[model samples]
Target: MSAVPAGSPVRTGAVVPVLASAGITVALMQTLVIPVIPELPRLLNASAGATAWAITATLLAAAVATPIMGRLGDMYGKRRMLLISIGLLVAGSIVAALSSSLVPLIVGRALQGFAAGVIPLGISIMRDELPSDRLGTATAQMSASLGVGGALGLPAAALLAENISWHALFWVSAGLGVIILGLVLRFVPESSVRSGGRFDVLGGVGLSFGLISLLLAISQGADWGWTSAPTLGLFAVAVVTILAWGWWERRTSEPLVDLRTTARPQVLLTNLASMVFGFAMFAMSLVVPQLLQMPKATGFGLGQSMLASGLVMGPSGLVMLLTAPLSAKISAARGPKATLMLGAIVVAAGYGVGSILMGSVWEIVLVSLLIGAGIGLAYGAMPALIMSAVPVSETAAANSFNTLMRSIGTSVSSAVAGVILANLTINLGTHTLPSQTGFRTVLIIGAAAALVALAIAACIPTRSPTPTPPATPASAEAPATA
Candidate 1:
């Protein structure tokens, strides 16, 4: 594996769009089943608890697979791993579309989750292939694709679920995946940059177990009793496994993740900032839709249909896409640290405003746009920060780890919001709903999380010094050393 010549000619117009489109296609998996969640028990002829696995399986699989796929991409080829990931997504969609029961649906969702590595891999590809002039906006667009797909998927999925069979959702996903796969094969070049090494099998297993235990506890703690044996047991296992995994990583010759490199202040602080920003960003996704769909009798509720709520939220995704260029400009001019801090401030302000303006649909849309802009700026800057701090060979792995941090943050955010909403519910004719106070409390927490991210970002170096590769046998196998 050797580095692509820096001077290799790239068709920027074709490469960027293909990669970004692929990224969006992968991201659409996250929200693809949301519209069918409430109806899952009836549709699948299973308990709600079993049906929830359809969503949980995806989250757990994604968390476990992201870092592993990234390492594989580095060792083999980014484009190859990327293609495999997209293939899994397509296969998953087809399986899900064809499934008539809960078990196969969960399996398909888990397979779909394997595509989580696509965005980070796309960013790495951009770094390897794009000219410096095009890199910033290109990565920005790729990063924003996550939000773009998620926001857009909600409305699209809602329309399909409303008008046709719920299975149509997966069928459409499979169709889109096929189209994206073809475009990727045609347009995206395999990066010559590679970190050739044996995969760390034990390290990967350790990480997967730890992450699975931790996320399972967080995501399911609300439904399971918070203090139940299962929740506590999973949390304990996660802590012990992660601690032991860290010990192993520190000593392993060719570790899965180079903990030494990750411990660098620039990398460490940027990752910390990413986590809190993820926490802040997810609050809107959890809160606004509920506010929209709650019955009008709830006083603050707007009483909108799921489709209408999705339509209102839809603009926020477009805002993210539209702001990518602006985010890139800010990062290029002031450094990614500044861009991240600015984004945090904007998000905090958005939440602050949202805490006050829960009265109407238009106000919710305004809040959604504000937060989306902030998340767009923050998300766009993260890859720049991570790539700047890590060696080229470690690019995908570092970015994937950063993404895992954000995922952890969102899981925790969901747990915390669930607890608050559950505890502070108002009764409305045999139904329990989150009170205005609960929503406001969640908004305030979101604002506080954004400020915490800003504080963490402030600690990141204004410019990361070029990192030296970790002292491992694998370092010699990297294109830089080769």
Candidate 2:
């Protein structure tokens, strides 16, 4: 529980690159399977609906794993948990690579999902190990890795799929996991920090079940008919479980999540805005690739290949990486609140571009870059905002919770956007595709989400810019005489 001695050496160079690489590796898993998704039914010898479970399984597993592993990292050692997460990624990739059927593939993908905890854990490590002055920049680049990995994954996977066996995709993932796991072991240090409390097994289980029920309902609601009994039942279960989880967390001394800390104005509002940001961020990813690949016969569709779609989205990821350092500087100079609000405005402007210019590849690329830069700025500042408000011991848990809020937002966006596009489809001879109006409506909603977040950020009570009291001046804590 004690801090490292003031002058103890901190290895800034090695830690930053290693943790950032680990983050990008884990994030790449989310998009790795995308390239092989359409052919899954044939590849795995399953019905279309059954094959879709590959995606759903990852979502459900990630939803459950992130919060639980985060608390584990706080209680035990961050590096230890980081290694475990990477191990799962490697094992999962191997399982998926060797599988010839749907069941193993889904199971493997879920295991990969368990590794989603890596990013938050990595962020926590940076907090514990980095110098105070270097903290902002390191965390910003670490956070931006989420977007970078996803953007890169698409094109890389698309290239493999086009040129090689679909199984090669999982093999690549496995190889990357192995290499990164080795680097993490070599470079990342175990923190002396520990909460030294009993694990809240009950709280963890309740939260897992609650998140599963909630995400299942959201992800499956469109396919099952939103009003179906199963969907409604899961939604009910989710609400009851979460409410009960909250009640239990309030009373448990060594709770998995400290509810009192999370309820503060700065933390609470930041989490709320993160949810809206997640919703807004996902709208573009959901819309853009589809817009690019849709048959040109639909007129508005660009009719690009899947590889081309991924290629176009690649620059967005680069911009996110390039913007992270600037975001960190802004947060350091002004405040994360100002940085977050700036991000929201930029994102709104990006959507504005999309609304007016949906015609060419170059135009779409520009819009995506703008939005990606906004996301980088916003993502980079979130951890700084959360860490400032909570005790140092709770950093991992707090960051984990914030990540969960974003996931929840993306889940909602998926369900809502899916329904909009599905219902507004136009039949073109042999196949159906989403209407131009559907795409426009989604963009409009995305812009609206960014603006809503901006307003929420504005409402967060800003701290008065208090000048520090003179160190030796008369005060209760200051000694009158030595």
Candidate 3:
């Protein structure tokens, strides 16, 4: 294996496509169920709050799984872990499809959520398999696709659900999962790099509990009064557990996360920016559909159907797909920091535009395009920044950490948006707009978050060099021969 040069074309042909498809699969599973949320009350004979758990359950599962799986991949093998995650998605889809009750559906969604690990795994694999010259573009494209998949999946799922049954969405996802599994088996080569350490079962358990406790509190706090014992106790446990987990990681020989490298200013700031961008981007995903599909009698709404509302968000994903390569080019020229700053400024501007003009469906769509472009630019830069700062050995872990941060941002934002929309009321005589005031408040929050990210980007020292190529074993051996 050492005889093969790192940049040798042998691996690129097989690896790149597989990694890209893996990313698409991740997005498909994550977003496919979103369109079904509004319909869940009728489908499962549940209340509105209970139905929302389908989305929340998936988020919770993915948040906990991403970092653990990334660490596992680093310790064992990326290809093996990728296969495991895809398999889990398939099983989850099947379970979801077969379910007649909300419990089964939530279980299935939780299972499928594990697939979120695929993004960080693919990004890490790209770092490992691709040459330095090619790495930037490949990672950028993969990172951008997360937004693209989300953008595209909403319409695809909405159209399917509207035309057929909601169960069809899961059926379609299962079919896609099978295809992704085959692709991985055929094209993705196993990594030779392995860490000879046992899995830290205790540490993983502690981390999972900590995250679950924290997320549970944040997500449920609005429904259950913040003063409630369950909410307060969960928050307290989360703080203590997370602190304990950090100490354990510092001492463990095979820690679940490498805290030292993650603590670096570059990696730390990049992750923070990712969280903010994630929060800002999710505002569109959460609010736009509500604004569009809401009954016109509600005064502030356009009364678009679910399918049409989803279609509005689809173009943003398309824009993200188109803008990714451009983002890579900008990062290559002006550096990732500049690209991130530019993206944040664009996001803030997009929200500002949204605040003024979101009364119509087309205006919402137009703002989505701007938001998608901003996400494409900013999301692409985050992984590049992280990969640059950490050792190759730490790529998966670092990327996973960054991915986790984005999830955190999205979860926090989703909960906050829920609160804002719930508290504000709009009354327009015969018809009351659900609450234009709430929408405005969330948009303002998003705009401010984007500005904070921009400020952080400015603070990131521009002196750090672009990532350099790793020396292949072949190159090292060549010197001996000479």
Candidate 4:
């Protein structure tokens, strides 16, 4: 395919803010329900496990939708797919807001998961449309927006939930979705790049089932005993289906994911690093709020309210937001590998600090700041690595794969952390704390995961050399004549 003319106008600058808004809307939807998780049981007459679906269902939906949407974007158009995703978000939020039962709420949240593709689509658009000089900063800002939205949305959602009602949070999200849709429709220019390929319907279906089976097994394993028949059956299905899906992708002409490109050392290693980073990053999201809000009556707990707890974690997102540009600079000066290693080391240090200091809200806040900075640096570097490694054509699919890895990492970490915390209970006479010992144990594990990612990042070779063009006799003769 021919490239756009060098002098032709591209509205990349105008597109950035609209994509950023979309990023924030998606991030907010993911975490806005967190502050309400504790109250859901009473409000909806549901059990803790059932209420937890509000969060997991969104995750599961995103896990399935991201890759599918990425492939669809490749097959159709990124801007078109993006608008469709935003429309889904608006509709989902409205449905969730109006729901009177957990079932409808889960369905709505699932639909919102389709919007997770917005970030990657935005990144791909930047690569295709932005000028070379501005590309680095634009990518960094877009990547940082993920954490920014999450951090900014947490406190906002907390306050809204505290002042109004839980449903109000969804209503606010619906409003933001509409505004983002308007911005995108008006400002984001349509891509001239179009995929002439056909969609892999069968591959998409198989992959979806494979992912759902695996995620459901992992997420529900603790609730159902690990050795139970249902768990074992799901695990078996996941293994067989994923293997089959892999085989199918390899044979098909236009695979849902380009496995050959994805298997490149740089791409593979970057994705592995993403998994470890995702695991460590999400552990904080799970542990910090719970640690802060646990009653002080239980020796090791601070016992802050839900709103206050969300606020404590909220600043970490802000720190991440502030550091994204700095991270881009670091990557520019050194390389994405160096930046990733530095970020991982910082994350390891943050978790190590958390393991030692868990008594006060301020202490947790300080640790969060460190972790947030680490995430900013690491998250910003990932797309740079992926984009650099893959051809421009594969950008969206490659990114979605990386995103999927991160989500899987988070899901695994959530399950593992849940088990550890569940097993370790601190007795406070009348009540119990979340085994301070257990929390410490999990933090140590998180720190260790970061160190492992740091090692992987360190091992990746410096930039691969660009191929040299062969000299032609005509060119050589011209040079001699000159």
Model 1, residue 168: what's the lDDT?
98
By descending lDDT, how would the candidates be arranged?
1, 2, 3, 4
Model 2: C-alpha RMSD to truth? 4.9
TM-scores of the candidates are 0.95, 0.94, 0.93, 0.93
Candidate structures ordered by TM-score, highest first = 1, 2, 3, 4
Separately for all candidates shown, the number of backbone clashes (residues 3 or more apart, or on different chains) is 0, 0, 1, 0
What's the lDDT of the predicted structure labeled candidate 1?
A: 0.88
The TM-score between candidate 2 and the true structure equals 0.94
Model 3 worst lDDT run, 10 consecutive residues: 473-482
Better of 1 and 3 by TM-score: 1
lDDT of 1 by residue, 45-95 (tens): 999888989989999999998999999988888889888999999999999
Clashing pairs in 1: none
Clashing pairs in 4: none
Per-residue lDDT of model 4, residues 254-322, tens digit only? 899978888878888999999988898888887888888787777778889877887888888878877
- Which residue runs of candidate 2 sit more than 4 Å off their true CA positions? 1-9, 463-482
For candidate 4, which ten residues in a row score worst on lDDT? 473-482
lDDT per residue (tens digit) for residues 81-179 in model 2: 888999999999999999999889999999999998888899888877777677888888888898899898899999999999888999999999988
- Local distance difference test values of all predictions, in order: 0.88, 0.86, 0.82, 0.81
